[model samples]
Target chain A: MRNQLRRPLATISVYGINLLHRQNPYVVAWWSAAFPGFGHYLLNQYIRATLLTIVEVIINYLTNINIAIVYSFCGEFDMAKSVVQPRWAIGYIIIYFFIIWDSYRSALVQNKLCHLAQLENERVAAVNLRPLEFQYIEPKKPWLAALYSFFFPGLGQLYNHQFALAFYAMMWWWIYLTLSRAHESVTLMMVGNFQESIAVLHPQWLLFMPSVVGGSTYYAYIMAREHNRLFRIEQRQFLAERYSHSEVRLFPR
Target chain B: MLVIGTFEHSLELEQALSLLEHDGIARKHILVILMDTDPKNPNQFLSKPTDLYPNAIEVGTAFATACAVIGTSVGFKLAWGPIFSGLSAAVGGFIVGFGLYLFVKKGIHKTRSKRLPEICVIVQCTEEQVELVTETLWKFGVLTVGRVKEPSLRA
Candidate 1:
């Protein structure tokens, strides 16, 4: 009986507008495995992702997992063993596995909901005008969205006009850039200060770059494609409503 | 006289619609029907999911990102360094993923091609205006067009 009350509207907010579309469950699971919170982010459960991400960063830092991975990779098994805090590591493991399972389960439920939403085929406002932000449905180039994220983590999100995510990603990218000393390392490498570049980098912070860059870029690319779909769906609705005139005669007068 | 044409859903088509309005066809005399794809053109997705599914680029981008993360993580052990290892993995991973996606798609579905005009516009007008209507549709690069005359009825 309450299924009628549960359908989320066009998913528009000052942050952005999104539609419930089907996402591959396995893909969502893989993203979560790559990074604890990314699967949730892809699911558009932003609040949970934000919280989980914050927890992952803090616990990972406390547990020294990144440094341990670096040490283990560098053949310093003893160093890796010595650095990790078992208590935090245990907790991190629990949370990590939970998110992966949670996301997969969520994806299944959401995928089913996606069919219902499609069946409903509710009308959406193409242009959403507000004083501080605006969102509109139009064709977006998926490659361009990927390219923007490649250049800078959050730019693709901005191009999709999903401002909340864009700003969130951009802010994190700058922090990663600053903390990793990535630019300084490149400058040094350009001049052949190889050891210095290694010395300047914080391995723990640098490690976050991979998942951050990957998750953001993938999300942006997918979102752009979705926006294009929304454009067609919207245009189709407009044409049908406006010009499929009821008065038109099937037989001549 | 009835004039009909098919078009892609694009801004140019919308412009053609407004121009038709300007050319004095009454709103009621025009009918728009969204067409299902011609069987010959099967890859283009509209109301239904197609072989490409949601996005064409997913195979390349998704795997690249996911694999790049693993490469970067494991790169700490490699002699060259994280940046080089990550880049190499992203490229290599994308190629492998793209190839696999294509292979699987090929294995599952018949070959596919580019777009076919998927919208149909039919206008009822006097014989004198048929030329004008056809010209407007043609100007928009309509994929196909046809004309028909309805028989007069006698009481």
Candidate 2:
């Protein structure tokens, strides 16, 4: 009876968001196929995703991949061949395919890990000694988290209560943006100053943007999903402790 | 000889290391690798434990010294006709030594990559002390234990 009295009646929403749903592995794979590190972002493997994205953009640019594709589409095969630096292009092919394969594999593995974690949470709840009082949290929406991260590199992590990671990410992102002059270049390009825009951009620093954006977006989504799962398990545990078996029936007679 | 053991938890690994220390194993002979299982635990994931290859620097220096000596001798012999053999020999020796140092460093890195794992303890000991070392590890409830072939202090 003391346990019942001690238990909090109200459910608290930790992040004040709704429950996160499971993501399809194929969908994640498709995202990665579209963009090299997108799948890793969806899987919440931030560092790997970031590194791969960085590699992808830099290699793609160095190999003149965009120009080659453009020339090929225009039926200028010779021009395409001329533009591509074979040395860098060969390395680009290896990394690009590897990223796609790795992201797909990681998605499958993370799905299994998520299932195992859920089971573990259930087991832990049964033996947990603490009273389920005062600290209730709600589920998070993955898409919203991703959207927040899209606006700012580390905002999603801040939402997830990961302060240090958010700080570092924000700091690095700001530095990259400043050093690359990416925004200014885009603005100039939009104003029909193509040569001036090209001159303003620093390829070395600009190359880092794709990876940072891909990593941030994906990380935000994954973290939100994980946070929601944890919230659900906690809520279940709290519910289990607060109500007795006799009081809460699955089906009424 | 080297004995390698894996442990599930850091506490158990620490206990095992302490037991090994109590048994008179030198601190330098023991190496531990702690793998992070929890993403929330930043301390575990972020900490880069010192590498096991303590002798890499010493080995690299030895190789560099040998190469430098050979280069100096060759340069002195080739420049016998009085053009400050000391300066040419010094430059040649430095270049050769630096190159050999880089090569040795690469080899050490390759060896480490091939042998090391995320969560294992490696201990270097004499052939006579292998049994005692394995026994101590077992007593502390190690997850697995085995003898590694050609276990050098350089690992």
Candidate 3:
């Protein structure tokens, strides 16, 4: 009776594990297309993602990309052209395209590498007893992970047991918040002081917001998925080791 | 004496460490250098070295100083006051110097040799224990093994 109840639970867990293992390369690429460095963040290339984000913000602001975008959207093509400095605009265009292509290529490569690593891990699990008896965490929901990051940049990392990385990200986020006066701007906007809100915001620091938010969201989701998959793998190994040769047989011949 | 060995997989490395521990080797003596093969593994995280040109900063500073001198002289020829001339020249010189530094650094980075192997195990032990350490590593099918000079303790 107990075994019968456990069978369905096992099947559900296996289905969840399969879902966690699969990461769409196109989805990663699309995240990068939406925001530079987001895809790299999803791939767990923190340093590269941070550097690319910094570059993207600096270049985007210097080239007046956001202002031009706003103007273009408002049907002011000439004003958009006028706002952008040609030399910097050219540099931004090149880098923008390069980042997209590079991120897409990297995502594809990393997906393949993850697949290889999973296979290798499975092989190791089959033969090794060391990881079998270790305590394992329950799989985390990707949406929940992303939601945590949306509230605070490093909370997701903290949830993933990356304490040091979480601290670093939290420090940076605090600095960004302070320098950008982001909270003040939001408060002002809410209170109907639109002009003051715009005045309070530092454009240079404000540019960091999209990257930080996007990167954190995507990174949290990816990390949760990867961690969940690893947990499933470890669970399988543990179960296999424990039940490979059960002494008590329930069925009689 | 110091011993270093490379391993392609973490499992083999883990096995090697356990073997060393079983042989009564001190935990302090065994150091695992996790390779940056996995982006998710943040062990020994380091920013990529982008400054490849030797003395890039000094070269940039020297160039800036030279440009400032030239600018000052040119400003004087144009009858600009010393203070205004100095300020403008300093800013212009800094911009030019920074650009030069970036250009040179990129070129040097392109030509320089790649960094060392990412994953390896480093063991610090007495001379007599070196053989045992090497044997243990060999038993676990380490990728490569070699002796290394004792690193300096001074900061």
- Candidate 1 deviant stretches above 4 angstroms: A1-9, A191-193, A246-253, B38-49, B53-62, B77-79, B126-155
How do the residues A165-206 of candidate 3 rate in per-residue lDDT, one tens digit apiece?
577678878877897787786677677776666566554454
DockQ of 2: 0.01
Task: Give the least accurate 10-residue stretch of model 1 chain B, judged by summed lDDT.
Answer: B40-49
Candidates 1 onward: DockQ, in order: 0.38, 0.01, 0.01
What is the C-alpha lDDT profile of model 1 across A142-249, one tens digit per residue?
A: 879978998898899999888777888898889889988767877886787666766677788888887787777888878877776677777787888898654656
lDDT digits (tens) for residues B25-139 of candidate 3? 7765665544554345322111124333323432433344444434433332233322234336645664676677677566444443333344566777777888999998988
Give, for candidate 2 chain A, the lowest lDDT window spanning 10 residues: A243-252
- Give one digit per residue, the lDDT tens place, for model 2 in B71-115: 322322232311123224434544555465555555444332322
Candidate 2 lDDT tens digits, A161-212 = 5555677679878887798686776677667766666566554454444445
**Deviation in angstroms for A121 in model 1?**
2.0
For TM-score, the strongest prediction is 1
- Candidate 1 local accuracy as lDDT? 0.76
**Strongest candidate by lDDT:** 1
Q: What is the lDDT of candidate 2?
A: 0.54
Candidate 3's interface RMSD, please?
22.1
Q: What ordering of candidates by DockQ runs from best to worst? A: 1, 3, 2
